[model samples]
Target: MNVRPTLEEIRRAPKVLLHDHLDGGVRPGTVADLARESGYPDLPTTDADNLREWFEAAADSGSLERYLETFSHTVGVMQSVEALTRVAYECAEDLANDGIVYAEVRYAPEQHLRDGLSLEQVVEAVLDGFERGGREFGIRVGTLVTAMRHQARSMEIAELAVRYRDAGVVGFDIAGAEAGYPPTRHLDAFEYLQRENAHFTIHAGEGFGLPSIWQAIQWCGADRLGHGVRIIDDIKVDGDRARLGRLADYVRDKRIPLEMCPTSNVQTGAAKSIAEHPIGLLRRLSFRVTVNTDNRLMSGTSLSEEFAKLVEVFGYGWDDLQWFTVNAMKSAFAPFTDRLELINGVIKPGFAQLKWSGTRPLA
Candidate 1:
């Protein structure tokens, strides 16, 4: 009889996350605690459960702009160095407990500067937290310093990323609403990273269309596409046959990793539902697709939950899960040697064990 993997099995399989946001993934209790400590007065609720519900409800508005508005409270409480460090540490701990072996968690350093902490201080605090969490939990955590695209400090943030490349920071990124604030506006940042031979990803094709992705790649040279969910707009599938547009062809041909966040995409109206998400088709077409949790708190998801949903919706099994996990590790901004080490030494063996011990039925 054909059986599916259980949720516990899914949690035991080593996973890699390439596109998680630090600010957006804070725990609800932590958010309330931070708010109380910082004396931030704007939180809608002090009860942790209610606060979590508010975040999820606020992000369910179907407008990307409205969805992003929920971050103001998260970012608000994260202004101090102590708060940033604690959040980063907790992010690593949470992901490790959720069976994530490696993750690239991102946050905008500029947004955390409201309390007079310098950019360097912000990076150091986060790195300290991640290092602490990694050591305690026996997991690997890397940071991606992001710049807000609507703002004019992308070049500065790019420089910050390069400055800390050998430190804990692994990559650079520009994230914000994708309409009026196109990625081309941040070309200088991408160019600077390229000149320095640093890695970076762009939040494209999520709230925008192909042009955003084109500029992010052809013009800006992104290492990965953050939430490149809109690539489906350029693809047409006909039963067993499929057609790809020029952009889609290039993306697939180049093996550009699409950091797909299914639940978050549905919450933001990027995809209609879990079953209708483009991830299933993209994975079938063999695009370098990787599942991620763009925002854990806002979307109420984890790496295991993301994989479980795919298994239930698309009938994905252990092999499919391993493929996505390996794809993410390969596309991680960490050094190639480190990625290979984890893939061969940790991820493959972990999934292999789960497949071999297939006693528990899928839930």
Candidate 2:
């Protein structure tokens, strides 16, 4: 009988994060420093605290396109190899401090080429950072190389992913506005990845609708759905019972992981409010729902904070937290042996310690 976990207890619990963005979680102070070093003048403010507030406020727009616009500043400062490596290192450290035992942070290589670094150079820089940071922080970090959906380089990026698959890069992704750039537009890339036998997740159903999700899974063959909150559109609820439509049923039956980033969904108007987020219904339906932080700096959140919000809004207990963590771990791009080791060795024991702190006769 695991009661609701306190924020402190939750902070200490091992968590798995899958949807976090690399450029989206930069430390504010580092952004300022990198901007100064890189001579990028686009930052709204050099003061770290003010910059943090600016990112959060700017990203609160109810449009995913506008929300993505905030990334320009963060990505602006991360250009050179040193800048990218430092950002990746700090990202690993931040996640570790927040008790995220394992995470897959994503970034677009094309977005980092403004300063003349090649795609391989960009990947190497980030990999170096994650490797060093993981070693220092005692956390496992994997990278997902992303291509901008609106761009025509998905195949290039997909090849890059495979070229470095055995390296720290674990998967591939396509991000940016999901409106005009459906996953099917990159069918060639997805097919290439499949032939290479590489894993990948797609940014679907966050800024778009059920059609977008359908294309990502059925057409593009994504191993996981990023911000799949929109799948609720296919689910009809009547009183305490619910009927899942064909697509929803298919998703659930296939156990396709839905990386649900509640705060980011609410910020981007994908979900109206945290209390009413589809994760509640999706979780109840056992839709392979997993919690995440799409952008920690933009959302002013960490994995623990995201769990805390669910605990506050949905009355999620330690059991629910453990379930989400395990779902994310199982859904991770990490090797099955690695994922199993963490789930059994770290996640389960961590939650047990928190929820079963003491023994007394319950009356």
Candidate 3:
């Protein structure tokens, strides 16, 4: 077994990613190609490198609307079945190259229907791409069908998720603007999923406050909290210690998973800085904290960059990385058998290599 290791070694360990947007991870060059194919102009930059910087700058402006605009160009090109398949395939390939062993890439099928493709067709194409990529690269991939919060078709989307449960679709999710569109607004969808015994996650407490998180868990019955970063609002800290309020206590006592994306949180103004992120505090508190890349292209980050950022800012070691890796495995949408296999066969062996080296396992 691989024993004590350096930080870079730990950071390179095989990872399980529970949060990443399919449209958000498109490479700038891929985006340019998609835009060109669709004859869609208005990209902030034409060159791949410059376009990457442009997306990052626009997202860093702290304007949610501007940050979201980047996806318009991506989704524009992904309207066709061929485009969706290619992007989804490349997403898995890219993650595998980054040392991600298993990843669940989420996307709103409704967004891709602009080209008149049915929701079933959209799901099929993405799942096909994921399967193809996984077989070709030996990377495990899953899909979370996301229903837009601002849209009224959540029930329809929820049904679609259940319909494809046996396929590559692993779970259902509700994402989009979280302000006025509280999880309660999608009560029908949530209730339906609950009745069908389907699992789901909700994007809450990112740009909003405690109420959003509360409704997501207590009202909407979310199995996990996406960007639950704002759950910090309910926490009070003293020096290096912290106290949790009633809601936070429930979340912790229940061992609910929080998908916290440091770089994306900073870009969206959810967290002031990496050092100030609630993830560090939550991790110290023994919360089931898992790191994620909420939006790779927009935030100009990868799972590797995210781990590096945490290591640099928090001085996290191999143990911390292992803890996060296990947390993600425990909270994955995959089946119990698959989850156990990943933890035992993949995560454990990967961590063994890192822990064997004394240097920081993440570089």
Measured with C-alpha atoms, the lDDT of residue 19 in candidate 2 is 94
**lDDT of all predictions, in order shown?**
0.93, 0.93, 0.87
- Number of backbone-clashing residue pairs for each candidate, in the order shown: 0, 0, 20
Selected candidate, larger TM-score, 2 vs 3? 2
* Candidate 3: C-alpha lDDT: 0.87
TM-score of each model, paired residue for residue = 0.98, 0.98, 0.95
Q: Residue 70, candidate 2: how far off, in angstroms?
A: 0.7
Write model 3 residue lDDT over 166-223, tens digit each, in one string: 9989899998878788899889999999999999999988989999999999999999
Candidate 2 RMSD to the correct structure: 1.7
Candidate 1 pairs with clashing backbones = none
Lowest lDDT sum, 10 consecutive residues, model 2, at 354-363
Expressed as tens digits, the lDDT of each residue in 1-363 for candidate 2 is 557777887889999999999999999999999989888988989999999999999999888888998999999888899999999999999999999999999999999999799999999999999999999999999999999999999999999999998988999999889888889999999999999999999999998999999999999899999998899999999999999999999999999999999999999999999999999999999989999999999999988999999998988888899999999999999999999999999999988888888343222
